[model samples]
Target: MVTAMASLPHIDNPVKLAVKDVAISYGGRTVLESVTFDVHEHEIFGIIGPANSGKTSFLKTLNRMDIFNPSMTFTGQITFNDRDIRKWRNVYSLRKRIGVVFPLPVGLPLTVYENVALAPRLSGVTGKADLDIIVERCLERAALWDEVKDRLDSLGSLLSGGQQQRLTIARALSQEPELLMLDEFSIAVDPVTTMRIEDVLKKLKKEMTIVLVTNLVQQARRLADRMALFLDGEVVEVGITEDLFAGQVKDQRTKDYLDGRFG
Candidate 1:
């Protein structure tokens, strides 16, 4: 059986994302507080928590998705590539560099080929040849190309739920994001498909930084070089994935959660 590296591939890599004393709120109620962590370049940084732990809310803050929700608020400092993301005047440009995949598959109503081509086209790739190359490369990266290569003309929505999820991944990769964030991407996926996507994520980390928010501790253990445990809107601990399971934790509750005694 294959196994993930016992430690980070590049432990000394510079920080790609830094969250300092961050807090997220909705309508004046804090959902996540005191979140401080640094995600290193080209590493899969996992966030694991139970429901209502503010994991999703924290992800929104990273990409500045709060702009879509007026009631949502963020405090503290978050830097991407050593630059304050809040200072960016162009949210579109920020989003282009940070791709996000939500819990559910959001396949566009367009054909499979078009769905993956849309981002490149919007980014000014007009040549059909260039688009074809991009579309194939992205789909292959997402592990969906071989299955749907012949069905590129089919509506993306017509694919199986797992296939659609992979399509969403392919679409995100088409942007060539420097940082990719996925929120519970496997919730709707089957075990087989989940494993396939996990393999894809393992390979993708070599190409980009990935922030993975998952409820499955085992999944995080398998993929993350390091991980943070979020409980009730607070980060309880952050450490190397293997070390955490080897009885390292700041709080007893974290140990319990990792042991499956509680979520």
Candidate 2:
């Protein structure tokens, strides 16, 4: 669905990420099954489910962090730009193209400037002028620049809870990812700030693919272009946001969940 690409204002805008028949297990117990999906360029995709569903586990697979857990095992192909993820020349390079923001504001111990500038510097952008420009641009995009610009030297942890979440988002944006994956990113923030983050995401999706794993059904209904319902390790259904919330979904389980009948 919606396979056209390279539209004006967005070239090289093909499918940025694809997960096909992907499954995962821990200690021989399966967690996900036959998961297949594509995150298109500049679209916001929402993955919604109850707590303990495999939302985070699925996001972890996109970045290949799932391979680190000793008990975890993954099967099937996760491709970026048509290249098999396992075959990616450098995992870090792939990760740089897909940034993640977690539910908690886990900012680094470093100052805000350093946190945002670290990856760009490591990627060979050594010029102070260039780094300064990048840091400012990403922070501004994440809606934290106006607040943090004058306090670039301040530690990120010192910011308020909402600001810290935005700081973490700014740090992810600093990498200039083609796709941004947010895992319940507003869970730890206030409602007002959550709305602010949602607004930022609405703007950001015009330039980057956004995959949001959230439990807030209303948020998904409001912000997503497409929505996927995850249940018991399977993608129960996926369709346009309007279709899913409009009671057109064909599956009983999905309808029940949407109606608050079950998780």
Candidate 3:
């Protein structure tokens, strides 16, 4: 219910996530090799790649989704909060701190309010008044409150494309996650709505660390403080957004890709 700006504590170690010499394989075919990176607190870190370049696979590794793939094998360390992610207090607890928004909106059978409140309720928030406040704050943060305020009782499937996407974002935000992973969030929405969502992300990044995976070069250039280019299952380059686009990357592959010669 508290709509105040999120107060981040001053810690000596500020990085939120770190991947250290990590490698992943499926059916003995390597998909990621020697991937290494650090995601700082409250910053937007963008990942860009062409199709089948392991962008989504790397994201799945962050939340331990690789465990679900029977053919997937992981090596090396993925550290979160200075501790190995595998050693985190619990997988579920780690997931609660990191939320994910996928490319398309998923319709729930419940009404809009229930859809947003379901996770919070599972987390032991049962008070009606508290649920109302959380839902309103989340919707407002996602920039959907104004449009859906009068339709709180409507089924989630009743929303338009843009509205449903925003609703999914609102649902994710209701958990108050410290890190938000957005995988092609704007791909399914209209241009105007995508811009709105981008603006919302800019505001949200003031409080949460945002990891964005998008195929659009422009989107990464516009919103990212830092960026990583992935190709052939490896990180080709990573640096400040302006630096990456300024023809300063050391890797030939990255430079070529940025110059529209290759991907």
Highest-scoring model, lDDT: 1
User: How many clashes in each structure?
Assistant: 0, 0, 0
Name the candidate, 1 or 3, with the larger lDDT value.
1
> How do the residues 3-58 of candidate 3 rate in per-residue lDDT, one tens digit apiece?
11132121223899888898888999998898888888988899998988888888
Query: In TM-score terms, which candidate is top?
Result: 1
User: Which should have the higher TM-score, number 1 or number 3?
Assistant: 1
lDDT agreement with native, every candidate = 0.92, 0.86, 0.86
Better of 1 and 2 by TM-score: 1
The all-Cα superposition gives candidate 1 an RMSD in Å to the true structure of 2.9
Question: Which 10-residue window of candidate 2 scores lowest in summed lDDT?
Answer: 1-10
The reply for model 3, stretches above 4 Å from the true place, is 1-13
* Tens digit per residue, CA lDDT, model 1, 1-263: 01334334656898999999999889999899999999999999999999999998898888888999999999999999999989988888888999999999999999999999999998999999999999999999999999999999999999999999999999999999999999999999999999999999999998999999999999999998899999977999988888789887778888999999983
| Candidate 2 similarity to native, TM-score | 0.92
* Model 3, C-alpha of 47: deviation from truth (Å): 0.2
lDDT of 2 at 170: 91
lDDT of 2 by residue, 162-254 (tens): 899998999899888888999999888999888988999999987789999999888998888778899988888977777667777867888
Q: Indicate the worst ten consecutive residues by lDDT in candidate 3.
A: 1-10
For candidate 1, the 10 contiguous residues with the lowest summed lDDT are: 1-10
Query: How does model 2 fare in lDDT?
Result: 0.86
